[model samples]
Target: MKALIVDDEQPVIVSVKLLVDWKKYGIDTILETTSAADVPALIRTEKPELVISDVQMPGLSGLQLIAMIHEIHPPAQIIMISGYSKYDYMRSALQQKCIDYILKPLDEDQLNAAVGKAIETYRVEASQALIEQSYDFLHSELSKKRAQRLFLLYHTSHQTSVIWAQLCEIMPAFSSMESCRIGILPTGHLPSELFSGARDLSLIVNFIHDLCYETGQSIASEEPIDRNIHILFHSELSNIPELCRRIVDAVREEFHLFLPLGLSPAAPFPVNFSDAVRQAEDAVQTCGLMYTRQPVCFSHVTGKEAETPPVFRMEEQLYTAVLNGHPSGIRIAVRLCLSDLTSGKGLTLRQLLLFRTAYIGLRMRWIESFRMNHKTAASLDAPPGSYFRLPFRDDGQYDLSVMEESLIADLSAISDYLKGVLGMGPASQNLFQQIEQYIHFHYAKHLSLESIAEEFSLSSNYLSRSFKKKTGSGITDYINNVRIQKAKELLENPEIKIFHIAAQVGYSDEKYFSRVFKKTVGMSPLQYRIAHTAILPPLDLM
Candidate 1:
């Protein structure tokens, strides 16, 4: 486990550093920083398990950092340390999901207790996950029988009494509910090494049972050989959205997997069970295809079937923006897609995640197309396609704000890569104009390949290759030509020393500058100046 301590005060950081012996609590690395602005990059690089952050700080407040950390690393625990005892600040920290709130004049005992509690929570969760993973090997014949009965109730048309009675016997939670909704959690592609062969189906079925059992929900319908697990819940719970979120979180945290859920609207029990199944099936198919973590609830669809726009329509527009290399176009494309998904009411967070899944495929394909078309791109040795996979992939949820941030970052990288590619081989008129203008303005100073590339937000290697391709000369050669051209104008003035002229042209050492001047002008700096001076009509002797 890793821990990060953040504070603006040096003494405060030092004090907190000594407040706890983190190694005893399973924290091997303790990363401390005084600036909150540095926290985001550190969070990405270190992936700390726990963060102790000050409330008021320069750049980002502790509460703000807490929110960022949660999105980037959902499992990481946070303890907010504030000098103020005001209720509003404490309330804000809690709202941000900080694990513990510590007031000014930190109490060693309170701090110790918080760290201990966090560690224990992590331990208990890990143990429960272990149990869930081991469930397939331990389930008995009775479990299999129960799963079979639920499957029969959902699939076959039967008397309401018969199905209700069987459901009550198998899972008593349904007996008292006036109405129930069924949801199907659809399995994704299983890992070959762990989920392969004859036992894979049984294991997946058992995994669903374990998930429901752990979440306090009852498994309603189960086809032992089928890949989807159907769940039953009382319709009366006003917080169905909360329940859905918990289910999604638990499955991901335990099994490191995501199963799209298709949920039915709450309907009268027994009579509506079959109808609920059909609704869930529709949702399942929709969500499974979209790769959303949220269960689709049929009751939420607002638009008429005729008005519903397909997700692929926006996806196509986004694909064009990526290929065209316009950052604003890509942003608009993603926003439109998200807007379409959310236009309907009762939209679960999981349904929103579908937007991510749908576009990720397009994003990866665009990257692949670029790599395949440009041999120069292949030589750059850019990161692999999998490098673009978001951290949310394993966490089984999407934080829209974080997703937006990720999209911008990815697009920036893609835009930069494309800018490099576009700069090569007959540059677009706009790009060529911009590069020339930039070079003309900043030719002075040590303008290396990397500095210019950084200015243009491109990879240095790619920029160098492309610039040579466009201007028919290398960047270094062009810079030298520009320097010599400037040196020629200065040589016409005898008042300026050769050394001063050399320094004025962005060169530090006159000797080296002289050598370049000779190579370009076919004469030494002094020889060129003297020759030009002789040709000039002798200065008026009046």
Candidate 2:
């Protein structure tokens, strides 16, 4: 480690240098510079692990120099030296993460202690960093191998023996294991409420590792693929079904939550890994659709026609009600449709989303037809890929109840938006009236379509359409009308100049105000004032 000492004053620098034993503190070289200006360049070249500087300098104060050095070398430890013993300076030094703040007229013992402390701290941190880096490299290599094993299993052009070689290196028991299988935790299998907002799979992975380690049933390696946890199991002693049952029981015991596990029929290693993965996925899909917590193995399930009887069929009443833009019956229709879909034995998220897309599309069209703000209306338009933006659990499981509730909310919003447009419903009408009243009162102030809409907490497009429908005039026209009416009252005064009258209203330009005056009132300000001014019948002196 290297240490750099910066001070404009020579005596203080020399005194400090003589006091500390740099070699004893593990500092191989001690670089001394009298100029604060040269500190940045030296920091780059020397790359010192420690910087000791005087707080008050000619060009750059110690605080400024420390900041500049930090930009060049963030990990370098800094110690502040100053003539002043003020608390503010000490507080500032602490805030900058300086290792030590030393006072001038320095103590030799204190200086040596601070130097020794900084060196020791760097040594410990460096050692710890090296250890962590090594661990991370190992974990990363293992994770890469796990991913490669899955890829080779699924894409299968590579020789299966190569995969076996890779697996055997990481997992010793896999060398003799005859069969293997992959299982997926399909969406909605685990209740979202259990994990809540956690997005990291580490907790669940750790639990699985602990369970497998304790039982000594099989060597389980977990890889998160497409937001689903796929656990690879290898065994020399235990059967696949027994292993699956142990996993499910362990989860239930730990979380007090039901976890539906699906296992592919164990296939002989290497050659049948791909088929096993597919089988496991299908089994998981079936378990998810049935909403069962038990482990469902493809090999164990026989007579599929008997276990899962088809229960879903489209109902015309719900479809027609949705088409007619009646939300009153949409809720019941949505519930019935969801129930029918979930009733089947094997339903996947993709299938469910595709079926719901048509109904949501119809609702979007219904919403688009209403006079709504462009932003809100655009939100109603579902992105080409997604149905709607809804929250899901950490494990990527969809909460059917939340999904259904969102659909209901969308239906209600569509109904409300339509009603407001057709009948100028009281709630919607009141908003328009409020906007108009705001314009009436603030006509003399600067106003624009966007600004007024913001004032009323509305979008410009929606407010403009609604205002035109209710008042029979556009927003700009209404503002000008209010200003013109006020201008006429001012014109009655006869003392205020036309330019002053224009300024009294919102218009700054007299020419523009006159053009508007003529356009609305059919006369110039001067002409209208003369025409309206009363003339007394010739004062009768006779």
Candidate 3:
């Protein structure tokens, strides 16, 4: 694609330029220098695929330049030009692997033919190099996948010695290391569909490798377990926080995503690797719930495991309200319980999540009591344990306002269900209308069948069957339809990006949103926007 010409005479360089249409030979850029000494430096920097040189120059001769070219860029195709027809020069040129030898007082046809031959040779070498590189890359990837599987097995299996031996066969460095620390880089709240494609996963793996290498750390092994990438590090524990910070910053700058890293304390190599892996996993779980932006360590969480009485007292008040069948009392109790959990000093997000889990267990016991006492009331199906799982922001941090609102809504729904069974609440038709209104209001938030059912104190099966029977649509379909409708309205504004619209409509993954939009509107989001709006400048799908 590029050619460099070296000659002592400026006129000779100009003649070569005018002799033939270099563009016809696929040489778009033509560089020239009168000094032979400058050729090697140019080759190193510019890396031109084709080289044309005069045999004799002021400083370094063409044969010497050819030797330097071979040492510097061996792939460069060379054509040697000489004024005299010297047999020794031709022999040396051939030894240096020059593609062609042209004589001075250059003939146009001969020069054109030589340039075409050089271009063809360059293409062939480049194609061959690409094939070899691809083969190497595939072999390297295959080895990495095998190592990842061994790592998973070693961490999970009781026989660590056997797996470590197998791992050292591929990664010999592990045999030399005495100890290592494990770190988990969680994808946080990013949708799993973002990594459903191998290209995306490979990009992430390469990006992480580059950043870690820059920080003077090499990943011994990296395995994707659940939503986190478990990385083995031979670096010191003190160096880990800074390395993690760099990795987090780089990922944020490059991928535009927040990646939280969690580290475990140093553990002895091979034997304690499983414990290290588990500690790293625990650290990530804590980091997922914490409000801080820094990386978390398993030790830090263990150091703050003190008891809090306020959470317990507030939970008791909530339990008492449910037992008394007081709907208003339940609302007040839910508020106070959440407020107490959040207001306490040094209370981590993990504590709040734990308290919620305990509260759900107690609530289930209360429901059983009601069933035993009110035998004449309609049969009440208990919601699944998963229905009460806390909702977190896309960044893997809790939003207290959203959490409080959701808790109130679901607990209030339970009160309504209990009252309805006792003939003290609204009719089924009115309740369904209220549910529809609630969905319309909170459509932008994370809404799921289980959470919605939990909010109304009704069983998931009961709500799913009843709602479809009345509205002729499933809850999930209704939710997606509502989101697509909002997305269409947002798409009309050309200023907003499609991904932003996806977030605004409660879809975290843009690609997933596009598919849903196409399924609902009979066209992709961009196509729909183009059809409805005036022509506008292009914007990224992300």
TM-score of each: 0.32, 0.40, 0.65
lDDT tens string, model 2, 1-542? 78888888888878877898887887788888888778888999999999899888788876787788879987788888888998987898878878899998898889888887777777787789889999998885565447445433633444456665665565556567677767554434333445643433455655665555444334344444444555566634556666667766666566544455667766787677777777876676544333444454453332222222111244343433333344666677667766765654545534554455555555454344342323444544432322332323333334677667766666555544444433324444456644654566467889999997775568999988988998899999999998998899888776667788899999988899999999999998877877776742222210
Among all windows of ten consecutive residues in candidate 3, which has the lowest summed lDDT?
Answer: 382-391
Q: Number of backbone collisions per candidate, in order?
A: 2, 0, 3
lDDT value, residue 314 of candidate 2: 42
Best-performing candidate as measured by TM-score: 3
Candidates by lDDT, descending order: 3, 1, 2
Q: Give the alpha-carbon lDDT of every model.
A: 0.66, 0.64, 0.71
Identify the candidate with maximal lDDT: 3
C-alpha lDDT of residue 180 in model 2? 70
C-alpha lDDT (0 to 100) for residue 338 of candidate 1: 56
Better of 2 and 3 by TM-score: 3
All models, RMSD in angstroms? 32.3, 29.3, 22.5
Tens-place lDDT per residue, model 3, 1-542, is 78999999999999999997887887899999987767778999999999998988887877888888889998899998888898888988888788888898899999988888888989999999999999998977676666667766766576378887887776776667688888887652344555545426557766776554333334533454554666777744346777777777766666655556778888887678778878876776554345355544554443343365344577546544543445677678877876666563445545655666566666675555445435655355543232343445544445666666666666666665555654434444456655664566567889999988887779999999999998899999999998898899989998888889999999999899899889989999999989999876386755
Question: What global local distance difference test value does model 3 have?
Answer: 0.71
